[model samples]
Target chain A: MTPIELRCCGQGGQGVIMTGMVVGKAAAIYEDRHATLVQSFGPEARGSTCSAQVMISDAPVPFPYVRHADILVAFSQSAYDKFVAELKPGATLIYESDLLSLDNRLPQGVVARGIGATRIATEVLGRRIVTNMVMLGFLVKQTGIVSKEAAIEALRTLVPPGTSAFNIKAFETGYQQPPE
Target chain B: MTKREAQPLRTGLHFMNGNEACAEGAIAAGCRFVAGYPITPSTEVVEHLARRFPRIGGMFIQMEDEIASSICFQGAVWAGHKAMTVTSGPGLSLMMEHIGFAAMTETPSVFINVQRAGPSTGLPTAAAQGDIMQVRWGSHGDYAIIALCPSSPQECFDLTIEAFNLAERYRCPTFLMMDETVGHMMGKVRIPDAADLTVEPRRNTTRAPGDYQPYATYDGSDVPEMTRAGDGHAIHVTGLTHNEKGYPDMSFAVHDALVRRLQRKVHTHTSELFRLEADGLDDADVVVVAFGITAGIAAYAVTQARALGRRVGLLRLITLWPFDEARIRTLTANARAVIVAEMNLGQVCLQVSRAVQGRIPVHHIGNPGGPVIEPEEILAAIEGAAT
Candidate 1:
């Protein structure tokens, strides 16, 4: 199978890099595949544009960065506007519904899905910081590029001490969201 | 004189960044002291060592500056410890004088330069292969140094160990030349068991104190056996022209012999020091030469060119210094042309040209530094070379 390329973009501190790390770890450590993650590094502080690129394959990933993403994940309006055009045709574009008002303009054969990740984290998980967890769960549900068990195993190994339970719960809630 | 029990190495598959893996490699290779000032891209290496040293039996000092950090590790080496310092381009510039100091004193130590774009602090967080030439010629005077370039997190872990071993074996400064992309990118690295690892033991003198000469080799080898301070041996270490006693002789003959030996110790070992990874070279028309992160990009492009039915191959340089001119000449003898792909405009590319000796056309595909060279860009170069 062709390797799956992904780009996750958002403001710094929104766990954009962490989202990529989780999937990379899941594919590399849990699923016994090759994965490479490269994050954008800059002088930007909290609210600036931050992104992470991840490539997963059965063979070793030669080019570390994603050139044209098979999946584009945007957590804010600016991120969606910036990265949506780079998605391959028939690629999936996932975004946070509450943060973006999509103009409904997408590349050819692109599929768009929006989840209220922030609302779900705040309302269901009682913590807005778990928003990336919600999106990660939904990403696994929609793409199935990485197995759900592998992702949860990655989250359990990577998250801070005593925070895995809450983050996994946030992830499950997003995973169970009905198709709209 | 009681020996401490060996600490267990972290053996197994691990998902980590290149810098973190380098730190683990250092520990596994018996590096117990690190003196470094924090710098971007390379800071995580010392950071990981700082957190790890306390738990194990070692020391990590945040020195006043890169100069202090560089020479400070040399001091640790003299005091009987395997030590190292980590930094990027700008910090590496500050450490040049001490790098010369280590060379002069025959210090067995490792210096890791996770290169960033620079004439001076050009890009702190961006990747570059700009320092390929500097690590060899940065320090003043005519002394040879060993430098290794690693393309992935796994090689980062493995080559860091090899760097330390080369330093120990040759009794000279060795370098792990990493760039921002390989240093920051995360991948899976498998560390082997401690028993399975081959570590070169430090060559210390067994001669009695009164009979021991600090710079004199008992055998025909140019490398002298070493003895740490307070090891019941009278020893002198300095940068000025010195004799077998390591004292300042300040004579032309003494200086010539000392300098020649310093260069010969590593220069004569070129066969053992040079490392190159050849892929699909047996049946290829064009060969791509690259190192560090650019090697990975070039390898991907080679695969693409193969699908297009071009007989292109890859020659990845794992060892940068003691440039493998002989191997490059032999490997590309059958090829139509050689293309050098790197992040810097033209550093190692020139070396390849010199090795090829106008036997075939040599082309370079590079940029000013920072943004990575895409696979498509390298693929285009392969096509150009093939035709």
Candidate 2:
């Protein structure tokens, strides 16, 4: 009964879809965990609003979705609004500072944290959507559902041959962010 | 958060998708030619082999559409080579006519449909367990379908091998009812060495190649080995009703004998082809029955329910068609209630209702829009049955 319900939310152009795929795949292939990755798309695949969910567990994970999340990652203000209600009282919520607004009250039971993901993306990594991978970095730091080495290996296999350097750097920048 | 860890490593693993594993499995099972189209979820089945074929001296052809994709392979199969084609729901629709033709022609071929959302375009990337009945009934007239459904990536790899074997052994078209989740989802697929696999070759029944009739029935098996064009076998195959001698027949004798043999080859030999799973039935009050991705979830629900002092068990279907009627009859004999869940709107539920003959009430849970059914929801259904 591992924490198998994972919901990831981000606006258009963010790599929310990729994050869900990596997490779902890592849970299933690397961890030998049962996993289901589900995503909804907008007008355009790359630049439209999108969200993804991954269910991972040692036991067979039923269905491909969750009524409540064990973990939630939001990269924008809209993401928080759309996904906040799905959180259980004690679930973990990670939000990016530059693109996210923390003013909204979380449900009485959930834990909320601010991760400066977009700032790190634009300043440290010099990109925006890499914020999605940065959120993944923090997720692994928070849950350890997948080892950094395993994620990297999954990235190597998932990402094309040439883009690994930029992705690895973006991921590490988020990995080192101080937990709030 | 600590490094997410689990039980000790199982050592051997290949980080691959179900479609890729299917192709590798086909290769391992000695399939030499593949024809398929690029339909979402199913596209990977051809994609993996497309890259693998030429490298290993096999043939991979991306046909114009699923109709050609399926029919083309029948010719390859007739050429005395093992062949297969993969597609999703809509493509399978295009293939039904040809599938029946293959049945009438007695050409051995395998059709792998990674089922998607139904009656139309449906969901492109979503997972649904529909198409159970469509695969059984879409093709016209009375014929038999030997269908196998795999629950995991490893099974996806292994069952593709089984699909080919059954195709050749029965000399009828076989099917792999793969759905989206299992097709594209990556998992720990163990690639067993090729040498370790037991492969079957195409059965050949040619009597000097000059006087060979393609539709002759072999004793006991009721299926005649197929001989192809230019082998001088004068192979005659048409979708129209034909007699054992490969000629048209509307007379009762040929019609009755030909149709019965097609059904008998599968139903009479059901034990040799059908596969299923049963748990908690030894002394259970409520049982969860599911197939494809839903089976994985139901398995977990059984564990949770049993831990909560509930008598819950699971029955997972690995072979979808040729309905395992005997197993269903025994499992439902003393059960308090049975819940059958799939991704579609009660296709298999109809089959289950017929099998039990209304002895027990069968509840239905379906998501027609390509969504996976949740475990907690299934758990509730199991609990609901108890009270």
Top-TM-score structure, candidate number: 1
Q: What TM-score do all the candidates reach, one by one? A: 0.96, 0.87
Model 2, span B202-234: residue lDDT tens: 777647765556777655578886665667777
Docking class of 1: medium
Candidate 2: residue B135 lDDT (0-100): 80
DockQ of each: 0.78, 0.33
Quote the lDDT for A70 in model 1: 93
Q: Total clashes, candidate 1?
A: 0
Model 2: clashing residue pairs? A62-B297, A63-B373, A89-A109, A89-A110, A144-B4
lDDT of 1 by residue, A132-176 (tens): 999999998998879999999999999999999999998898898
In model 2 chain B, the worst 10-residue window by lDDT is B1-10
Candidate whose DockQ is highest: 1
Q: Which residue runs does candidate 1 get wrong by more than 4 Å?
A: A103-105, B1-8
lDDT of 1 at B302: 93
Pick out the ten consecutive residues of candidate 2 chain A with the lowest summed lDDT. Answer: A40-49
